[model samples]
Target: MTLSVLVTRATFADIAQRLHDHFDVDDNPDDALWDPDELKRRLQGKQGVMSHGSDRIDAALLDACPTLKAVCNVGVGYNNVDVEACTARGVLVTNTPDVLTETTADFGFALMMATARRIGESERFVRQGDWTKTGIFDMFAGSDVHGATLGILGMGRIGRAIARRGSLGFGMRVIYHNRSRLTAEAEAESGARYVDKSTLLREADHLVLVLPYSASSHHAIGAEELKRMKPTATLTNIARGGIVDDAALASALRAGTIAAAGLDVFEGEPRVHPALLGLSNVVLTPHIGSASIQTRRAMASLTVDNLIAALGAGPQAGQPPTPVNPEVLAARLR
Candidate 1:
């Protein structure tokens, strides 16, 4: 009777099967992303909400949800959820972190290889019946992933995992740029050398962005940065959107400033920039970086756990595995 939950991405049928007995559940299985006003209307009586990457939980939304106790994001990145605002408003915020690290890292590597090797373009060509024994050298011959320089924009857990795959598994020379340098032991383990952003852009055979999005990170890779990259280099982004300037990236792709690009996320996502969509050199995918069936299910389950705990359903019910704004755990719960 004390717990109320609102789930945005997953359906009622899904959670009802699991938590119906413990809490009041309001679910939107249809996955309709409610606009600001509609979301405000929905949050009128809700104490907890489960959200996806697509949902925006910022200052405006926090101003409306007076009863909101917690927001459990189903994705690792909580950039969509403003931690400062939530902490101020006493709303507990948590995300799926370690559970999706390896899965997302694996995906970043996969997308990078796809971009460097022109995999998607080759597939489209073959599917269009363009294949023959001759295999025209210019048809789809692309860059090699092995023995290449792999550069990572952010060297967090997922980034380190990608570095291991590239450096240890593929014989790549890994380089990364982060806000702070990692310990010597970490560098030795991953075999990644820390370099400045410009050096990373110039030297890497392929670059992947895994950085978290924030005010300072918005448009981090714009014309100036993209122009520094090797013309033969490929680029991949599995990070949060807006980190790379979409318009700038599209121009680079169209102009062949970079060999090619693979993207699983975008700026202002779900509403991709039309220019980026029209380019053949760029492989666009619906944001599926953490979308493996198993990982997605785990994310869903973890989100549910956070919501139940947050609304005081049980022990660890109010204590999430990953809390972005831990201070909210002590705020007055009306």
Candidate 2:
């Protein structure tokens, strides 16, 4: 019997075709965002699903889809999926990690630079015809990026990539705070010094958030944290939404708590806070951290590979490369 699979969102043509060739595939080519009930209805009888980061997979949904054996997420962060719930149900969970690390790191660095140097504000000023009335020195004077202190909240693969870019390419001093310290060799490669969270906040000229999102991390940068930051420092978030308090951030920008901010994600995404929309010091972009064409394709391919292997249908059958809960698979074998 052929296993059934569902693609929850539109993807690269080749990826959809590949899944079609291997399974009884049901794809949402229209790329509609399904609510919980609608998603549960669509998932009926499906043995596997290729999921986007926006799709929420939880115990209730898993209960609704008894046939689901695997969930392959196209993004590195699996915050959308309830791993413990999936594991209890013996449903394999996988995410694409390394494929988009460098691409995302590139965007993070770019957003930080844009925020620091007021690139987005200056562009808007030019387009609004305000530039014609102002002289060069008096118009849009912004902060410098070179030789600044670069603080990273997470020192994972992408964080290390950002640190290397700041330290080697831009001559910036790199500091980071993570749950644990990296190896001495890894530290030497990125040229980052591990510091306490408070120090990372106080000393950084430009702070970048690349940490994973979780219960403890939600509102990690709240109003109090904002007050701890230097008045001239710029905050850039290329990490998951809900990691920072958007309302607090807006207030911070208004009060000049920090010089500026660049955000690619939000607390309730696709529905940015009205307050942030009104601020000139804050630069906002819809979540597109790993959005480069080449990297997105790579991520799609990895998700497909994971789904195939998890369902025991493709090359490397029974061994999905990046399982979020490998113990579930081990328990199944036992």
Candidates' C-alpha lDDT: 0.85, 0.93
lDDT of 1 at 204: 94
In terms of lDDT, the poorest run of 10 residues in model 2 is 131-140
Q: Pick the candidate with the highest lDDT.
A: 2
Model 1 TM-score (2 dp): 0.95
Clash pairs, model 2 backbone = none
Q: 190-227, model 2: which lDDT tens digit per residue?
A: 99999999999999999999999999999999999999
Report the lDDT tens digits of candidate 1 across residue range 1-334: 4567777765446644565667677777687888868777787788888887777888888887788878888888988788888888888898988888899998999999888878898889789987767846586778999999999999999999999999899999999999999999999999999999999999999999999998999999998899999999998999988998999999988998888989998987788999987887888989999888788878877877777777677567667777877777766443
Candidate 1 residue 291 C-alpha distance from true site, Å: 0.7
Q: What's the TM-score of every candidate structure? A: 0.95, 0.98
Candidate 2 — which residues are off by over 4 angstroms?
Answer: none
| Total backbone collisions, model 2 | 0
